[model samples]
Target: MQDFREAYQSTAVEVQENDIQDNEVELASPWQRIGAVLINSLITMVLYVPLFVGTAMMGDSNGESGVMWIGISAVLLLAWGIYQAILMSKTGQSLGKKLLGIKVVTLEGDNPGFVGTVLLREIVYNIILTVLGMIPFLGVLISIGAAIALLVMIFLDGNNRRTLQDMLAKTLVVKA
Candidate 1:
């Protein structure tokens, strides 16, 4: 441990961070991720419910009940995720990430706001994992794959505490 710290000190560059409290400087756990997701979900629901209700009322005024409201809601949710990713990459914090006292950055604490990186990590990778899980019987296989990916992210060895998305995005979550 002493040797590792010495090497890190000699080789690793320290990044100047935000006005983050010293006590908050800890690698976020999976539970923290869950909390962020919950917060983001709540925000999304607030936006969705109103739109759905308004669509229902408009549909009632017409001849038929409009099921397209559900479809629209789905699209809106996807849009929200994209928006969240953009905000997270730009500001280093999503609404939840900010509330939870964590921000995503690179190992060197620089955030690369490349769209390709964002899509690769948030849209392509995660959605692929999720889609596989939707398949019956194949869901176990999908879950195993996703678990492996998540484990790889959580256990980043000595380099940094990051997940697959972090690696792909060259980013990490630290106290903010």
Candidate 2:
């Protein structure tokens, strides 16, 4: 043991230092992401409130009126999706994330492009969700399972702090 310790002590070692800068990034906490998502969801709901009310008021028990209401809702949803995509693509921060001083970036700590932020992070997952939601009871179960799995990943990802969407886009949410 003494000989081993002597040998180990005699060995020289080097430690590499990181280049610290003013723009050093910090990993976002799970709570921060959750809060941001909730706040953003509220904002989205607020934007859709008027349309929802109008559609509700105009909707009739008749199947004919139902189709129109569905069409209107679809248009509004599409518009909102586009708006969110544009904001995320340009700033790497949604309104909630901006307000919270958190932003999304690539794994290497650079801005994720429109394709990464919008297409991979948002649209792809939503498309899956929408498709699954169209199915019957099994779909609901699967959707719930997927959501739970995402939450688990977010919580278990340690210092990396990535969610499923982040994993998919090779992105990270970090303090700005």
Candidate 3:
């Protein structure tokens, strides 16, 4: 009986050690996450510069130049989206994340593929937020509150600093 108990205890310890190693990931700090977000936002805003310039050059009239500019803007936006999706899917790092030395990964420490990164994290999450924002009277307020809640969740999650998008996509941001 004593020998059996010893064997069981050793096996349990080995299992525990393996579990700990599996979950050993250095989570990104809140500041790093915030920096990444700001960097990404800046990149997005920079991408709109051409659109703004084209609009200004074309004036208020919907002439041929205006239409062309609109087309250009659409193409630029689409290209940016594709770039982000590709990077996120391949390496779990967007331009901002790469700059910040952070990456998005599954809870198991694997890169989240396109379905998780683009579909669930980006498209579905944005759709939900957009739907909430489009509600009748309280739409704007609800949307703002939800955004705040998501941000707060990142800070409040003691074990894993996951936002709502991360939770929905079953992903985590960790140091690259």
Candidate 4:
């Protein structure tokens, strides 16, 4: 009985050590997160350049060309969103995050999958912000304030470094 107990205790310690090693992750710094966001915003703006150029060249007098441009822009935006979602689901890194050498991962350090990346992190917060911005006189201000609050949370959360979206999605942005 004494020998069996010793064997069990040793095995338990080894399992605990392995678990700790498996779950360990280096969190991305606040600056890295900010840089990634900036890169993403720049990429988004660049993607829309074609629409802007087409609109400028066509000069929609009859509103017909304006509708076409809007359609094209919508398609382009949808494609971009899909591309980002795919990357996030598979690798936990959007284009900007990949470039910045950081990635979003579950608490267990696995890829966040589609629901976490698309629904919780991206769609839900965006919908809330859009609704806030659509309100009356204080709408845009409230939206901007909420965005700032979310950004500030990253700085405040020293241990986990999670923003609101990261909390909601049960994810962390970590060094790749």
Q: Which stretches of candidate 4 lie over 4 Å from their true place?
A: 1-22, 60-75
Q: Which stretches of candidate 3 lie over 4 Å from their true place?
A: 1-23, 56-62, 157-159
In candidate 1, clashing pairs total 2
Residue-level lDDT of model 1, residues 1-176, one tens digit each, is: 99999878655444322222232456776667668868987998876974676566674764234455666677787888778877866877788888988777655555656443366667677787788889999988888977777766665535456676766665667766
Clashes of each: 2, 0, 0, 0
Against the true structure, candidate 1 reaches a TM-score of 0.59
Tens-place lDDT per residue, model 2, 1-176, is: 99998776555211100211124667777788888889989977766665665566565565556556567767877887787778899989887888888889876667887988888899897898779877887888878888887777767745366777887887878887
Order of the predicted models by TM-score, top scorer first: 3, 4, 2, 1
How close to the true structure is residue 98 of candidate 3, measured as C-alpha lDDT?
93
RMSD of 4: 7.4
Alpha-carbon RMSD to native, per candidate: 7.4, 8.7, 6.6, 7.4
TM-score of each: 0.59, 0.71, 0.81, 0.77
What's the residue-level lDDT of 152 in candidate 4?
A: 84
Which candidate model has the greater TM-score, 2 or 3?
3
Model 2 misplacement above 4 A:
1-24, 59-80
